[model samples]
Target: MSSPVRYAYYSIAASVLTLGLKFGAWTLTGSVGLLSDATESLVNLAAGMLALWALLVAVQPADDGHAYGHGKAEYFSSGAEGVLIIVAAGGIVWAAVGRFLDPQPLDRLGLGLVMALAASAVNWFTARGMLRAARRYDSITLEADARHLMTDVWTSAGLVAGLAVLLVAPPSWAVLDPIIAVVMAANIVVTGVGLVRRSLGGLMDKALPEDEMRAIHEAIRAVAGQGALYHGLRTRKSGPRRFVDFHLLVPGATSVARAHTLCDAVELSIVSRLPGTLVTIHVEPEEEPASFDGHAVGGACAGGGDCGSCPGAAD
Candidate 1:
């Protein structure tokens, strides 16, 4: 439905097409390196389909069972992709070790390299576009997809270079094919671990980055430019959405209508600046108990959904 989602669909198409091309190349040349590259493309096909499904679910409106919406589904998809990467790497290692034990001569050298490079070129362009879309939408699904494609591009490039060397290489150097495959696997292991780490952080509801957090603070200050007091500032990101909430301390003489108006203004400012952000403002009298002021303690501690140990935190 959205631009980012459209890109996801395109990714699926690219994965299917490339997988076919790479496998055909591997079959023709019998190059273990090309086989390794093609194997990774298969994983890409599966991951792309999963990402599409996750993005669809993530865009659904909040329902009774999911008050916060289904945005976290994207993290699950990302984590799955990470696991898939590791699995693919293991498969590559196993294949490489086998090939290393019994080196085999390759055929159709020139043709295979051409096919592989063509697939890589498609991925190169697709990955570049996906990276741009990911940043624009702040969608982890697209980011993971982009990272996967970029890794594929590099792996394909390495395989082509290694195969090209075999064209003039002595017969004794055939082992290099499998060894290079092992190296490619090692390189992808790092990518898998990084994706898994990012997915877990999202699942844990990581706080916004320092820059965006600063923006949230600035928006609050600008909307309450008259010096209204606030505390209990907190923020978290869920998929493409941001959540922020805080306490608004107003003078006791201020009428309810005026307090409501101020809260409305602050929420509008933040939503406008952050985009897709949800803000909650809890209004209270300036003279409220000390617990109110200490509740959040510099706006860092989560307060454990209670007053917490902060002396000024509300009960």
Candidate 2:
């Protein structure tokens, strides 16, 4: 399996183990906060499994049906994970409200809190590793999985705090447990919204960031040199790949083969500067002095009294 698939698989396994442990602790302690944390873990487990599947599907080679490949599967997986997080938050709110209605007497608060803390620590490490892998590989699925794990860590920490407060504080503070659970649920909902936004952007083929576009422009100019002009730059992301397409204007007299060579050279230069990027260049012959500056025109030629076919000819 690819690195992304391996990372996602391990993440899914860790989430499953975490869910089971947190649920068991909740059963023993009857802590509403722990229940909320467990619910989030359940969502994490489901999301991780789906992420693994998405990683697998995303790595598939481009087929006749999908010329751009199956990378967008990651976006669907991410959106699904976001929806699951929202659902988990709703469940958490319901559990917290139920606990407020009929508060359960929590037991072994210290032990349960310790267990939750341990689970949180595990998640912290797992999330860090997954995030590192995602950055190195530029894998969207792994990044989403990492975000889910980080959410688990935060929710687990919140649960630990709520339980600790409930144990030491006066009876009047018992409500803090449910209150913290609500807060944790709200936090999850906020994170879910962000994930959904990113997924939607990916699905919608949002343009590349301005900085990236500028970088491409610089790279093209560097390869084409001073005389050439470019426009109609566009870009999009597909899983780990960046698709960049742009138009380049060259002198009319430049041979087609040489222009093709120059285009290849520009692409190579850009690709060298950019990692995990695919570029397509469309060459357009310089028609007239559409936007040329004086320096672009080298000198007068024999035919038209001007090197109109030369760089900056109209200029």
Candidate 3:
């Protein structure tokens, strides 16, 4: 088993532990806010399992059927987690509304708060560790799990603080329980929507971030040195991997071996700058008018001396 998959196991174990604590707290106190926290923990458990599966699939080597590898599996895990979170949020809102309609007196506030605090501590430590691992491995599944765990920690803390206020206030403020749950639900919905959007962007092959794109350009320029131009630059990311494609224009008199060597230097530079990056360079003779025919972004232009239609113009 890989290190990242082991982190997923830790996440699952933490989820189970936190879920037990939070659920016990909710049962003892009958606080809707605690109930919401417990519900999100349930979602966390499901997400961790899904993330484990995704990591397993994502780490698989490329095969004949999947020439690009299985990296996109991580996106499916995150997207499903997002959907589960939204569904859990809906359940929370429903429970909160019912609680608001028929208020109930909370019990064993001291014990319930202690349990919630304990659960939050577990999640805090687990999330911190998973976050570090996620950064080290560049695993989206681990990052999503870590971020969701952090959200649960914050939610539990907020619930504890709200219920503590109830311990000192009048019974009329019991409505605050449901109010806090509703607020927690809203926050979860926002997180869910954001995750879903990011997943869709990944599935849609969204371009690499500007900083990485700039790095690619800089690498090419440094390696190609003088009397060279490049265009039709494109880039995208899949899980931990990055893909970069561009056309490198060298002098027409340059030999094929020299052009090939230039391409190798450019690829090495880019990979050094951005690890896990796969660069594909199309070598073209600078003096040939046909070399500028097919630009990736805006297609061919009528007058093609780096016109507005060319992506290189903007670069």
Candidate 4:
């Protein structure tokens, strides 16, 4: 009933409808290109189902056994979808090669083309909606699904254009149909590889985008005060959640209560800028003699170099 779940359902329904339409087109015209398009839709349906389940799992509250929640499960779904896409492309290549060699004439061109167009239309609209929802909620699973659907729309468009050309071109150009199918396979291969790479990146705990990092910096700058410095700023994203950790250096003379207040203000500012962000600030007394970047420094550290007033300290 959540927006992501609803979008998943929409994806499943659309895939089913488009699958039927595309296969019908393939059956009517015996075009291998249409068959390949239908096969991708079939992959879409399976992936959409997987995405639905993943979304459900991801929504579950974190438990004692799994403190970070089940959001990473969505990445696995997308990775599997990417592998499935590659398999679909392989199937397409095999079918295309056979058709290219045999050179069979297509039939009922008009109806098949119309059906293909209808399927593309559905994909185009669904992809747009999914993308909007994904950005709004910061759900990578939905975003992956949207990207997959958009690829399908492009595949459908290429097939439609190729088939239309086949209808009027010379007999020598009949080979164009299978060739177009091969080209589409290549296109989807790139899409699949991209999805896989993104899946791995997410699973490996990639940092947040530059824009998000900039926002974090802005939030910190807004709350940071004189004699307060930050270091070891780190950020990572897992699905809709963000984790941020940094060391906050403050004047050692500052009271614990005041430091806590400052920490709260900075944390709240970051959370406001980035929803679902978990911030951890380690307060360090600037007056405390501590190591800075492996160098033993005096209490009064500007954070870049050693303290000036301490023995054996750098200028």
Best by TM-score: 3
lDDT at 244, model 2: 80
lDDT of 3 by residue, 46-103 (tens): 9999999999999999999998889999999999999999999999999999999999
Model 1 lDDT tens row, 1-315:
768789899899899889999999999999888898999999999999889988999988899999999999999999999999999999999999999999998888889999999999989999999999999989999999999999999989988998899989987888989998999999888999999999999898777887887777778878887464666777888889999988877788889899899999999999989999999988878786763664544464222233355446445
Assess candidate 2 and give its TM-score to the true structure.
0.89
lDDT of 4 by residue, 1-315 (tens): 777889999999999999999999999999888999999999999999989998999888899988988888888988888999999999999999998888888889889999999999999999999999999988888988999999999889878987898788777777887898999999999988988988898899877777887787778878885434665566777778899877677787889999999999999999999988999987887656462322332222224322343322442
Model 3 CA lDDT for position 203: 93
Segments in model 2 whose C-alpha atoms lie over 4 Å from true places: 288-315
Task: Output the lDDT of residue 235, model 3.
Answer: 73
Candidates ranked by TM-score: 3, 4, 1, 2
Worst 10 residues of 1 by lDDT: 300-309
**Would you estimate the TM-scores of all the predictions?**
0.90, 0.89, 0.94, 0.90
RMSD per candidate (Å) reads: 3.2, 7.0, 3.2, 4.4
Question: What is the C-alpha RMSD, rounded to one decimal, of candidate 1?
Answer: 3.2
